[model samples]
Every structure is written in structure tokens, then in C-alpha cells.
Target: MGTINTTTNERFFVDYRITLNDGQDIKKIAQEICIEQTVEIPEDCVPQTHWDYGITGIVEDIIPSDKIKNQVLVSISYHCDISSYSVPQLLNTLFGNISLKNNIRIDNLRVPQSFSQLLPGPRWGIDGIREKLDVFNRPLTCTALKPVGLSSTELASMASQFATGGADIIKDDHGITNQPFAKFEDRVQRVQAAINEANAKSGTKTIYCPMLNDEPDLMKKQVDFCLKSGIEGALAAPMLIGCGAFVSLRRQTDLILMAHPAFAGTFFHSNLHGATPAFLLGRFFRLIGADISIFPNAGGRFSFTQEECNELSDALRMPDNNILPAFPAPAGGMRIERVSEMYEKYGKDTVFIIGGNLQQLSDDLSVATGLFLEAVRNCACATKEIL
Candidate 1:
């Protein structure tokens, strides 16, 4: 059964794939999810007023699958009030306790506009980012300043070269925090200066995105520092910093938020356990105001399949009611030689991140960056010619 529309009550729907044990009653599992997700007590124990007001998870539909023995698809709807208009709370309501139970996995969630509208969607989505880069016709090029031991000056030099060679966005490697080798404040100031200098020289508008990984108060200060330094964006790992923390940052600043996929693998490591890559990296990240979602690309060092990558990309770009689309930055062990292949698979709206490969390809960072830019442009031209 599909989603049910109820105008009488605003409900957010969650779809679950439940694999049953032999002789296990399917109705009992559905009822357990309903009670556990909402009131967390026996159904009869729930207050009558609360029940009338839709505070309980209503099992809208359940269908048994013949393909898999004891496997059933269940759709449960919970009133929007259960979420308190918070991403973390919403997540809790969706699969907080049920996640601990075996053989139950969240397949998808359909958020209604009433609840979704209160959240911070992307401030700079696909169009906004393209406008900032002024590269409306081609896929955007991105690279990371890496090898964490480098001094602020050294990292700035790398930023300048990448920016000068036509990289649209230059971000600090996720491994870079406030380490002594390159202090956060010093690194951001120097890198922003270098990128600004390069942009001035080349008449290109390359942007620098620093990583923000401090505590809440300090992270706010870092965001302010970036804004004051004329930096337009920053990278954040929601899994490391809590999702609530990321949402707070989104509410406070207009900086382009690029979500990093560090420490997120555990959620998708098991087939029957955690959420899918599409849900975490694409749907949820975009909903939480990530203008760009970076994930380990298929055929890269990561274990994600090509089908999973395509599904994640669709989740990022596909239209949701009012939520703007985010750019899918497929990275992680991507090589310079694979630009054409990536462009063909992901199309022009993507952001291709090539990092260590640039250094491996050429000793001169500027020359290697140039080759990457040329490959991307060539692919765009060929795609256009074909069309």
C-alpha cells in the first residue's frame, strides 16, 4: 500500500521493511512499531485525548510479500507534533527504538510541507552555487587542500594553485581540524587570502570552504570568522558534530553548507540494519540545509555500488515539494583520468572532487589542476555536441 493523505491531521510517513521470524505474527510487529515509535507504552495505556489528537503512530497499511518468506512492507504515519519541528527529534520518532530491534530497517520517510517548511533548507542550492561560480553550463570542479601536516602558508599555496587553475570550490580536507600544524584561524585567513588573490589574477570566482569542527560556541565563532574573512562556505560532518549542531549552524548563517561523509559509514554498513546511503547523504542531508552532499563515489575506495551512487544522486537532485536540490559531490579516491566517466554518469549538475590524485598526477599542483579542469570541459563539450 502507498502513502495515505489525511487532511484531518498533518502526519509524516515512514516506510519500514520488516523481515519476520518463523511463526511470528506480522500484526504484532506492526503494532509494536506503532506503540514503540510514539507513546512508548501499551496502546491501552495511551491517554484517550492523545489518541484522538493523533499522537500515536497509525499503521496506515501493511502488505505481505510473497517473494520473501515472512517479509512485509509497513507504512506508518505519525502526527507532525511528535517531531517538535526538529531533525533529531524527527529522526528519533521515525526509528529511534525500532532501530535496536533486529530485521527492521527504515526504507524511506515522506515529510509533509507543514513540518518540512519549519526546517532550514539549503540557502544556496544548485542554482545559487552555479551563480556563485558563474559556470552555468558545465559541471563544477572541486578539490581539497590535504596532507594535514602542512603549514598555513603551504595550504594557502595549494589553494591558490587550485583556484587559479579553474577549480570552482577549494575546501579544507576533513582531517584538518584545529591541529597545531595548521591552526584553524591561521589556515582560514591565509587560504582565503590566497584564493582571493588567485581569483583577482585569473578573473575567476573560486570560493574557499574551510572545515568547521569545533564545539557549538566555538563553531559559531568559526562561522563568523569565515563570513568576516569573505569566505562563502564551510564543510561539516553531521555525524561527528551532532545533526542538531549542524542544524543550528544552518539556522545561524547563510554560508553554503557542504556535508562531508566522515563517520557516517556505520549507518550503512549493514544491509538489514542501518539507513541507506540515499536517505542519510541525500534526503536527510539536503533537508538539513546541505547545499552540497559529498559521498564516496562508486568505483572509488568506498564499498558503495554504482546503483547506490545513482540512487543517492537522484535523492539529491529530485524535486521535493519546496526543498531545493543539492549538488552531489562524488569523491573519495576519484582519479583525474575518470572525469569523463564521472561526467557521463552524473551529468552537468554534479560537482566532481579530485584530491590526492591531482598530486599523484603531477608534481606541479597548478598543472595537475589544469588537466582536471580541461578534462571536465572536454566532457561538457562532448556532451553538448551529442545533444
Candidate 2:
């Protein structure tokens, strides 16, 4: 039998393709379909679309075919199961059941952002992280120790210097990998040691969140290594690995969890389909346990507008959300001059990541690092007073 009984304020479209193990009465199956939808959609958003056609209501009329309803799709809004699963898993379960013979897929999930708003955000937002680090006066300063091609020693040396120069967080370049020249395990060890040494000497609480985007099985091992090595957080690209990967990793491990926005371009391109920037990067990333969600900032390498970026920031911190509040690490075309502007506009809930521009600014990374830190600090302090 299909699921019955919808919940209140829940809305979702359940598209299932029913395939019988044997065969059942088509009429019985249709009735079961209504029941299944009821089970999926919460009560509130129901009856509203119950009688409407296409997206709303049930399959009032149908002709059973020999093959499954591959072309057929159902639209439903149920009391979304915001209790247990991550956003993606919720999506999967919402469409997991139902006779595929009748329902094929769940297409057009509108305002998943609305549903996301119902989830928890990051644990520590931008200002929150800065406060945790005792960095009150600036956009929290950060940098990557990189050129993935560099040796472990070379990488470690650079990271130590960045830490010494006041880099709040020094991360492995997202491109760094387990290559023989600079294996993930060895490089992480060296870089972490360097940062730790710098902290010991300078009394600065710099953190190192290694990039751990590897095969699923290998991914967990690497995360374990980072933690065992005393690394504070990690960088995982959900787009490159897949959304559930992040949630699964976060659930199993205890890392600060910084999300990188790689391979997520397709969804934001269309206004009508897929998900919005704030939904995927801001709302969803936090739900899955990202302490910091990085995206392409405006006037940078990518083309997100100021409005889109602002909405993303708001989505990251909507008070009603239960998700941990994550820092909005805006990168791409960010530079020294715009640090003050970004801190003012986005407020303290941001981590301004300046990459190649930092390199371009000064040959001496330490000097460049200090300048970056000072710039964000000035902005943070100024913004705090105004607020």
C-alpha cells in the first residue's frame, strides 16, 4: 500500500515510478498512490494542491501500461521530514518509495531554501569564529599555503610563515593531493607541525584545516589523520565528491568542516531549476555541518551578484534555522581594498579568503599575510562600532 496521512506546513513533490514485483489491480495501485503521497507530504501544504491538476492532486485518470511510467512525474508538498536525514537524503527518501510503475521521479522542488530554513546552520558563523579566535577587530584573516606542486617541506615552511604572520587559518590549497611528491599524509603532517611550531613560538592560535577530498573510504581515513594530527578542521568540496559525502563525513567525524564550492556551477545558472546559491552553499551546507562555506564572491573570478551574495549571507544566519551558523568564506575576486567593503556589507559573519591576489600583492607572504589580517581587522573593528 502507498503511504497515507500528510503532516502540516510540509510541502514536497513526490514523483515515483511504481514497479510491481508481480502485478496488482491498477485501481488499487492508484488508491495506494494517494495513500503514499499522504505519507510523504505533511498536512498543511496538502489539500491546497489536492484538487489542482498537473502539480497538485492525484492521478485521477490513468491508463496502465506494460512498462513503468518512465515519462510520468508527480508533484507533491508534504510535511517535509526535517527531523532526521540531511537535505539530500530527505530528498531521496521522499521519492524512495511509491510504485515506479506509476510515478517516475520527483522533479521541481521549489524553495528547498524554505525547507532548509527549517534546518540548523553552521555552529560558528563569521563573527562567531573570529570571536572564538579572539580576533575582534578585522574580517577574520585567512590564507592557503599552496602551489599543490610544492614539496611537503616547502608547503610546511610557507604555512609556518603564514601562521607567524597572523594567518588565523592556513589551509591546504584545494588542489593539493596525495601525489608521491607531496603525499596527503606527509604534507598534512609537515604543514601542521609547522603551524603548531609557529603557534608555540608566537602564542597565536592558528588552525590548520587540511583538504580531505579523496575517495569515500580514503576520505574518512584522511579526516581521522587530520584530527589525530591535531588539525582543527578540514576542506571538503561537496560538488566534487557529492552532497551526501559531506553530511556522512561530518556525522562520523569531529572536524570544524569547511565546505569548498567546486563543481557547483550548474545549479545556480538557471533561476527556475536546481537550487539557488544561498540554498546550496548557505542553507544546505550548514545543515550538513560546514563551519565555513566558501563561495565565489562578487567582482571576483566568478560572477555572482552583490544581491546574490547578500542573500547567501542572510541564508547562512537566519535566526529561525536550527543548523549551526557557518562562516561565509567569500573568495574569488576579493582583494585588500574590498576587505572593508565586504566586512561592512556582510557584517562580522564572514571569512574573507583572498588567494592569488595575496600572492600578487607581495613577494613576501608573511608581509602580505599581515597586511591582509590588518585590513580585515580594521574593518571588523569599524563594523562592530557601527553595528
In order, what lDDT does every prediction score?
0.87, 0.67
Question: What ranges in model 2 sit over 4 Å off?
Answer: 1-76, 79-87, 93-128, 383-387
Report the C-alpha lDDT of model 1 over 253-311, residue by residue, as the tens digit.
Answer: 88899999999897788766677798889888888889999999999999998888999
Model 2: ten consecutive residues of lowest lDDT: 99-108
The number of residue pairs in model 1 that clash at the backbone is 0
TM-score, candidate 1, is 0.94
For this target, which candidate reaches the highest TM-score against the unseen true structure? Answer: 1
lDDT of 2: 0.67
Using lDDT as the measure, the top candidate is 1
